[model samples]
Target chain A: MTTIKVNGEVNIQPNLAEFEFKEVLSSDPSRKAVFLLLNNKTTGKAAILVADKNPFVEDGSVINEWIKDAKLRNLAQNDIYGSYELLMPEKFNAVKSSLIYPATDKHILKYRRREVYMIYETADDYKSITKPSIKESLFNLDWVYNFLDHKAETDRIVFDDPDPNIGFMLAPDLKWNGVDVDNLYLQAIVVRRDIMSVRELTGEHIPLLENVRKQVRRVVKEKYGLNPNQIKMYFHYQPSYPHLHIHVINIKYEAPGAGMTCIFLDEAIDNLKIWPDFYQRATLPFVGKEGDVLLNKFREAKRLNEE
Target chain B: MTTIKVNGEVNIQPNLAEFEFKEVLSSDPSRKAVFLLLNNKTTGKAAILVADKNPFVEDGSVINEWIKDAKLRNLAQNDIYGSYELLMPEKFNAVKSSLIYPATDKHILKYRRREVYMIYETADDYKSITKPSIKESLFNLDWVYNFLDHKAETDRIVFDDPDPNIGFMLAPDLKWNGVDVDNLYLQAIVVRRDIMSVRELTGEHIPLLENVRKQVRRVVKEKYGLNPNQIKMYFHYQPSYPHLHIHVINIKYEAPGAGMTCIFLDEAIDNLKIWPDFYQRATLPFVGKEGDVLLNKFREAKRLNEE
Candidate 1:
């Protein structure tokens, strides 16, 4: 296993191991850290954290932390349920940027592209995308899994039943048999271009530029109604992929990726104890739709980086 | 402050409360124990746990627990997250002659005649139903509370977020914060119903239906291309609206509703946690585009029920 430890936990690392595990996001595990793969020969000693997780990339505290903590630990039996296993690289730093809403023309272009991708070629495309195979099963959630197996690459499919209520999603091939059966949410793969545009900016920029991490989060939430707490973002500086994108994964309520909430799940539910407010606050960024305000800031920063 | 002690737990008697809460069609929380209203000088004090945490029921045990537990505390502290406290009633004992399916010509006719009582109508039917204000805000969930405040209810609305990835049934006036939000990923909902119905029939059901829960989860992974774990289900139940239903909400990896996966805004997500496998095993009698196999089962069940 090639070990690569990235910066603050925004960059996601998939659990390709035989079991499930959690890595810290920040100094205080509740904050954000990097997810690392600990191995001697493979990817070498490296770090992976989402660029979005860092607000200010230049700060020595943050930078030095990345430089100093450059070791990857083999996921111990106990680590499976602790943190999301995220780490950042030393070369990268976070910078805040101004808010710049996508131009109408640009919005139209993106929409059209998405529309084309959705519509595709035939009636079957529409049918397959819209129609759900709601065949009742005896034991397994087979239809969902089957659908995932088939449509793992192309489109996003949603299934609905009557009562006009509960729904589900089918992502690509994600495995969990015994060691990591509990945390069964999808793992999102994000690319670097999704967040950064390294242009040059001379004038005073937004102070929030340092906090590019939060901006990426706001965009993801606004565009997709993903809750931050349930999901963990991973960043990378070219250990595997070239661009620096954040991989966001959904950690089911039952998943140990919950950190403090895990404490609540372990303690509060049965004890009837109140969930610590900090857990609630910490996970607040994950609720609702992604906020554009944050996304715009990142986009502006990217634009300035290019200029 | 009407406290009804059940199993020695001081719960605000859901039955006696302003918003009725029930436990309908559940496998666990066996529906045998009688519940007293503590201070109900009005209706019969004796109540029973009705349902398990099934996805089909709007407010299953999951909803009731959260309201009686978390939200209630939040309300008391005056944290004021949003309006509309969710509740799960004790029984889904209200036997209905027919369960309407959203498909088939007959279903539509029945919906027009028996179920849908148009309390309000719009001059421009299509226009009113697909109003820009509602359309724009449907997926744009960040403005949820804001939209609720200004949404006009002069016409009945059926949510269809242009992007089929999301579906909702929002009745602003029908909510506590003066707005009720019920969003579902359409395809996934159908898959969940089928899975739930199948479980209802099969005796071998997990008390906590996590394994089977993946039926609908596939769509988030493959179809919409989301992090599967990122999708969260929120559930709520109200006796005034007899029956059960759950709202399927997806939290992006970094949005606000992330960390607290178990924390349901309403009863929509929780109820699914405990739904009996019998419900998942059972099927819908009517067949239509929406019903899938559940409809076929429903038809069989209807015949059996009639016989």
Candidate 2:
């Protein structure tokens, strides 16, 4: 084992073994990291050492293909799907000498690229710019229809509500790996096909909304042992698919698109109750990612307050 | 100079000089990081090298007291306040060899601890729980008053509106280092003292809100060359301070409390227009962090559906 030593000028010398393991601060099984608090034996100075599993790289030449001395423990098996904990040979560990490290240029670029725009979508803009752009070809709902018809992912469905008007089918979202309970994520696909998005909802749809919320809370509690308050239910404005669906996630899970893009189900219900024509008349604001067609449409229409 | 080499089994051997500098992918002056795309001369494989400045550690013994070959670049200077870029010698660099890495237990714990709870606050809950708890002892507004009176941060103030009823003072938030224009952040503190938060806003405050919005946009455009659409104006539901201050930020900046805790100024205006008593009667949902007194109050009142 190669040992690293630090001098008064904080120079890295490669001969002396200085670190003596004191205690483990934290451990993450998923990330495969253990933060160990160590004391320098010679100088008696405390230091934090992060021992993490190295991630796979895109370069094929750097990776070793052989899986030597492999051991597998079955975690769960359902139908053809099986989850296992694999123990392999010669796993490389990346050690971070300390937590205090300057962020990389890639990190800054990533942050810079995450520039979000809030589009103040008026009713006219929705009709002229949004509605026309969302052509049927934009999203392929054949798979969604197939799933609703029980022709796909039949085994994965947690519960199905057959009522066509005031019902939805609950299923684990693809994002959830079905392993971590703290980061539980589920989706409720409505039975009705008429409502394209939250923009289409009215006071008449209150029952449907309430029913979905109630059923979701009940099933989540019964199945996952998660209380109603422990989970958040919301809808995406520019949802990935045209089909109306509600995202039900554990409160602990801070999913992407939760900020400016999400509208709470409870807020929707209350708004509808307050005004029957709330969705129709209200100038809604939603985030548009860079280079989105809808955003381009807004730009072309001169809807954005840009110079 | 120390060199690292990798073999078929990916062992970290510290003798061979294998990497050759190819190109610089990105650079962040603020983070002091440079991402260099390198090619292994011996193996003819490409790799990403993140050259980052080592951060200051808490342990005093590990730090060097001497500063050699130091240089300073004055970026800006204003009335007893100045900003400079410091260049110091013998700065250590931390290198990350690969992007793929296993998350550690500390990362999981940190993510898990960010569990946000949304409280469905009613008028009764506000009166009985929220209002009574904020007994003026919670937040000391003396510094704010001092600033408003031109006794503090007077040099930092961008502009001031003296009208007590429909006026505010715009200043850069302390959180903004004032170096990065992309992550520009400013605060608009209302002149009037009666209004506590968004909850107090009715149709009467439309002028105040609109004035703040307009002035913020105009000043930002004139001074920073940022268009109206490139910035966002919002209010924190359970604000850090009771004073009714609006947060103005660049679209690229994603502040910590921007999610469920934030209420857009436009939304507030729209809601107030829709119903004069919208804030008064509405079941406002705001996020409460873990161990917050308000969260505890909600728990005691059994407002949360936790078991």
Candidate 3:
């Protein structure tokens, strides 16, 4: 819409030329996360403003940022947890958007921010920062495509042919020790068939997990050409993948996150038998490394106190 | 210690004749359910006055219940769901000498009991009510005795013989169908050798659950004289037993709690392989019939919304 002023002074109404659009991304009923993409016209920079809807929208601090891209709909993450990318590049014209009167209708702009996921440093480098999960961001994972793109995730897989029910794969992980280590197969992962990750599991999904030892043994004996007795499986608490996966390793090799960190799948199944929502109900205890943003998220949520 | 007064205005101040004792029941760093056995000299009725340290020592709420024969710690449930047997025999005096207070100091006690477990009803009725597991009332199971008692629980076992790792047995249970059903072996249970129940399990206990299918197959072949595929194993959520047992029933039988209510043992093991605290973490969701004390506890805690 265009408006012209009768006097020499140009009169611009609030909604004039203020275009906006909205889309539901990775939604599943409630949300796993919600975010905003804001481009500054003055500094010529953008930020993937991921947060609980409270901060991103209602709290108005995000509104205070004077971000003009709120109406632009073409921005998306390079991948889950990766920095955002805007498809149509443009120089924003919202420098006056925050200063415009009628208060709530206008944004309060701030430039030069820190501690956020910034992508325009360059296009190719996708730095990942997991979006905080909120009611609006419940992720509806596109598993079929993941199976297509990362399906070669099965490349490191051995022995048994891959089935949608299960996948036995060598993790793109470091060896617990040097190549000189005795047990090379000591670190591998097993993924769930029907669901993406552990968080999605209900008691109903437990059966798919049953008899894990025998199934793994079949894979070990048939696929790896190894003795079934030597293999053991493990699932680390607060695992790295967003998917529900298991690690199968040689019993002889002592790997990191082993022993107590390792929960026998059988025990987990039995526990679920007694309490189906065990994963959801259990207060997870985990250690954070130096640059762990997850720990920061936990600290922000008061789930864990920061040191 | 005894307080003697000659005239009517007797000086029975503070610790004149206060008597007290302590009992250590299921205890950890923060809690131990302690109680006093008191006897009403006039009524000749006894009660197990149970409460926390304060109610037992300083406050006299627990002492007022007047229980008899507390050293007769041999009290047990008429049924696992019923009350303790302290009511059966009723002549008690403070047997233990704590030497703390003067001896039976004062009675600032009133008795109008709205909540308690009572057992005088009968024994043939095996009412099944799970206990509410508050932090103060965590179970301390006695396993060695269950082994001694239920060790022969393995004798009725058919189709499968006991392995050091796995043990199988037929339970003395009624058919799922009323009087019409046959094939009782469809409801057999497999008990783990080491731990009492799922709560005691850690990663180390997992191997005992491994190759369960193979063991089950061996049983189906040898003990049942049937094909391996005919049998299936189920572990009910919030099962009544203190021991870790798996139900190895015929797969064709449509037992109650089968699909979602029951967790397949195999799935349990697999889940544990990922996160060991599966059972401990899962919030148990169950329906309790009226008169079930545990549900009453949940109601008290507001875990489930009131009807």
lDDT of every model, 2 decimals:
0.25, 0.65, 0.36
Error of 1 at A284 (Å): 22
Chain A of model 1, TM-score against the native?
0.18
Counting clashing residue pairs in each candidate, in order, gives 191, 6, 49
**Candidate 2 per-residue C-alpha lDDT over A82-156 given as tens digits, one digit per residue, 9 for 90 to 100:** 233433333221222322112233422333333357777877777888888887247778888888999999988
- Candidate 3 A-chain TM? 0.43
Better of 1 and 3 by TM-score: 3
Candidate 1 lDDT over A63-91, as tens digits, reads 23442432222221121111112223423
Worst 10 residues of 2 chain A by lDDT: A92-101
lDDT of 1 by residue, B1-307 (tens): 2444544554342321321222121111111111111122344232221111111122234323322322110111111111112122222111111111112344333222111000111123213332332334333332332332335442433232222212223332232232221222321122121222221223332322332234334533454444433445433211011112234343322222233323232111122322223123211111121233322333343421111
Regions of model 2 farther than 4 Å from truth: A1-115, A135-138, B1-115, B135-138
Which of the predicted structures, 2 or 3, would earn the higher DockQ when compared with the native?
2
Sort by TM-score, top down from the best: 2, 3, 1
Model 2 interface RMSD over true interface Cα atoms: 19.3
**Which portions of model 1 miss their true places by more than 4 Å?**
A1-307, B1-230, B235-252, B257-261, B264-307
Evaluated on chain B only, what are the TM-scores of all the candidate structures, in order?
0.20, 0.64, 0.44
